[model samples]
Target: MRGFTVIWLGQLVSMLGTGMTNFALSFYIFEQTGQASALTIAIFCFVAPSIILSPLAGALVDRWNRKVVIIMTDLAAGIVTLVWLTIVLTNGNLEMWQIYLGNIITGAFNAMQFPAFSAAVSLMIPKEQFARAAGMLDFAGAASNILAPAFAGALLGTFGLVPIMLVDVITFLFAILAVLVVHMPQPAAEMIPEGNKRPSLREDSLFGFKYIRERPSLLGLQFVFTALNFISAFGAIIATPMILARTGNSAASLATVQSIAAFGGVAGGLIMSTWGGPKRKVQGVLLGMSAENLLGPIVIGLAKAVPGWAAGSFMSQLFIPIINGSNQAIWQSKVPPAIQGRVFATRRMIAQISFPVAVLIAGPLADKVFEPAMSSDGWAAAIFGPIVGTGAGAGMSLMILLSGIVGVVIGLVGYSIPALRDVEDIMPDFDALTAPIVNNEPAIQSQGE
Candidate 1:
């Protein structure tokens, strides 16, 4: 727990820096070009490499020293930051391609970092504490989401990009130092599942999918989350535009509503950390997500005012941490420590595959399909318009409403799957298999702080 705590604190600092830098860069690009497509390209570069390369990265994490992986990734990321800073300092300008390339490099580093850090977590923390640990991890993300924009906005206005980049570099140094000092327990020889044999890198890279396929419970959970991710992405893709259009493009109102909503995620993490989720973790995840999916779209779709949208958004965001924390705890408790890197990576890759697709289509869907349909003279305007109302962003609202219905159906279907719902009962806990070396204190000395 102590080692995990140290790493968590370090990662949170790094995340805050990363978040601020990302916000500042995105703002810079948008301000310079005034092109929405530029922002899209930047985001694509940020996420695409990680998704495409996660399988290989996961295989490496499982094979390599976990602490080394964490340290090296941070080092690589820091180096990229240094290069960016150098370009700014020397060249006095940065091309879009260079920024895109840097984002790709950082994304690749993150692909490896996530699996390594998550696998390391299961080793350092007790099985019963996985939920609380997951809460703390999520709190990092929620806190960054809330704090980074505020912090970056102020710093970018006062000190400019140079100071923000320097701060990011410092944060990376802090993260690397923490990893260097802490000892991460490695998987023991005996911890490998019985009869499992080492294979080539290619075969091992695909092993996560194969391993999940062998277990109905694991497979079912994966499918459920894949659906959840796909559904959630649609709403996320249009959340800002929806608010802006509905609120008559008042940027302050949009920011206020979003910030208020984001606090829900932080609040949810705090609650989960205290409660440690429900006895039936899967049930808790499904029910919480179901409420989030069903209620949010309805309120937002029918919202005639910003307050309505804000309240709905707040409730929707609130359930995210609960779902994520409960889901992570289940995976941590069920999967073998040795193979967790591969398994968790595969889980992330599949769940996130929908996001890029969603982002790509969201604008077109709203502009060509939904928006016109809900136009004053369009066919859908007569039907759904009377209900959700008509005009700008109404089609997006309709999409949200439809997406919510689909999400609810998916949750109900997941709940009905006995294998998934009863996963804890059917799958044996991996703690028994990995108990011997789960906590290796020799690898990490307690630095009397």
Candidate 2:
């Protein structure tokens, strides 16, 4: 508990630093290039490499000592930040290409850190506390979301990017120090699934996919997330535009809506931390998703004012942490600690696959198809125009409303599926496998005497 607590606090601080750097770098690139494309490319560089490398990273996480992996990732991330600071100082400015490269390098290392950290948490904390731990993690993310943009914006105006990067480096040092001081527990002998037969790296890497393929319940759970991410992408892609259009393009209005929504997330995380979620994690997940799916879009779609949108958005955002916290708890309890690295990585890869595709299609869907149809004199204008209004963001609002309905349908359909609804029952808890670790000694050992 102490080890997990120390590591969690360190990582929370690290996340804030990372968030500041992310905002500052994106701000710098956007300001320099004066082009949204350059900013998007910078973001893609950060994300794509991590997605591409996750399977291999997960495999390596399983093969190596997780504590060492955590320590090395912190060191590597710190070195990356330090190098960027050096470049900015030496050159007097960072080029767009250099920023892209730095993001890719740091992102690749981060791909390894997340799975290793999650797997380690399962070993460090009691099984009953998994939801509470997940809630705390979500709280950090929400807090970072609330603070980072404002912090970076203020600092950038006063001090600029170098100081922000320096702050990030210091936070990484704290992270490294935290891991160094704590002894991470390992899987007991009985918990190792594959006996002593070591395979090639490629085989090990693909094992996560194969493992999930055999488990219908886990696969069903992932499918639910796939649908949710895909549908949610519509709202994410158009949230700002819709707000701006509806509010006569007021940036302050959009900011206000965002701040309120972020506050909702913080509140939700706090609630989950206190409640520890439902006994049936799946039930909690379903309830949260149902509320989000039903309330988020409907309220925002119908709103003509910022307060309506903000209220709707707040209600919607409130469920996210509960949904995620409960879902994380289910995974932590159901999956064996030794193999969580590979399994959770596969989960990440699969769940995220649909969102990018959705993002790519959302713009065209809103502009060419939806916006035109909902024009003042167009076909859908006659039918839905009166409800959602006509022109500008009307079609996008309609799209949001439809997307919410789709999410609700997905949640209902997912719950109707026996394997998914009964996932907790179908997948037995793995806590017993981890109960015998006498201390935090390394549990890398052969099976069956």
Candidate 3:
């Protein structure tokens, strides 16, 4: 417990530093290029690699000492951060491709870090504390969300991105030190004769998919997320930027708006920490998704349509992650421990495949189809006039509206699917929330040999 506590604290600091660096980097790109396209590319690079390299990373995580994996990732990440800063300082100008490369490399290393950490947590923490611990972990991110933007703004106004990058490097070093101090006791099963063991990598990576294949319900649940991410793309990436451009807010103000949204996430995290989740984790997930999905576009679109961009963004930020965390809690408990590295990674790969694609198409889609129609005196005002509005942000608002409707429809249809609905009943006993309802029997107790 002491070891875990120490590691968690250090990682919290690292998370904050990571958040600050991201904030600084996004604004730096904006300041240099004055184009939203560059910023979108940076975001794309950061996320796309996880989908690309996850299978290999997952395989390796199951085969390695998990603690060593965490430490190595921290050390490598720190070195990369330091080198990037040094290069920027040595050179008078930074190129767009250089930043793009940095982001892609960062994403690649991050791909290794997450699976190892998650699988390690599953090994280290007892089931009773799993949801509670997850809540606190999310809270750390929420806190970072609240502060990182402001911290980056301060650093930018004072010394700049290079200094903030240094701070990130230092935080990584500190986090690595924490990992060094903690001893991750090996799982008892790992001590058994090597020949009798499952093929660690192959078995781990394929297990989650196999589980989903057999259950169908869990697969359906995850499939719903895939649908949601693609549908929401129209609003999240496209409409918000257009709205801000129309309103004449600077890059800094937009960052501030995002920070306000983090405040919402913090509140939601705190609430989940105490409540755990609803009696039925799946029902809570569905309910939360339904509620937040509608609110997101409304908040995002109406802000552009009216004068409430800040307020709208804030509300969406607050609720969306809470729903997401609830979904994560469900998966964490439901999936078996040995296969989590591969299974969860595979699930992540599938769910996020659409994100980069959606991001790629979002801007263009807005420019070619949605934006033109919603412009003043465009077909939007002439035809679909009432719901779309008649102002600067009309097109963007309409897009948000459309995405929201799609998220809701997908969620409802997902709820109706018996396979997804009954995954709670059919899958092995995991969480009490869905366990008894599914099996009509007692729960499985963990009895290590």
Candidate 1 deviant stretches above 4 angstroms: 25-41, 81-99, 156-162, 190-197, 244-251, 304-306, 372-379, 386-392, 433-449
Query: What are the lDDT figures for the candidates, one per model?
Result: 0.78, 0.78, 0.70
Clashing residue pairs found in predicted model 3: 217-419, 217-420, 264-318, 425-438
Model 3 TM-score is: 0.86
Q: Give the 10-residue window scoring lowest on summed lDDT in candidate 1.
A: 440-449
Which pairs clash in model 1? none
Query: What is the C-alpha local distance difference test score of candidate 3?
Result: 0.70
Over the stretch 29-140, how does candidate 2's per-residue lDDT look in tens digits?
A: 6457643346546655666667678889988888788999989888888898899999988987898888889878977887888789899999888888889888888777
Tens digit of per-residue lDDT, candidate 1, span 1-449:
88887888898899888877876786677556643346556677767778778889889888888999989999998899889989988887678999999989988888998899899988887889989988887777777667776777778766767877888899999989888888889875423333344466897799788878888898888788788777766666666566656666554565566566767777887888888888899987777778888777666767766787878877877787788889899899988887788888888887777766665666667767887898788889888987788887788788777777788888888998899889989988876643432223112221211
* Shift in Å, residue 321, candidate 1: 1.5
Q: After best superposition, candidate 2 residue 175: deviation in angstroms? A: 2.6
**TM-score, one value per model:** 0.86, 0.83, 0.86
How many clashing residue pairs appear in each of the predictions shown? Answer: 0, 0, 4
User: By TM-score, how accurate is candidate 2?
Assistant: 0.83
Better of 1 and 2 by TM-score: 1
TM-score quality measure for candidate 1: 0.86
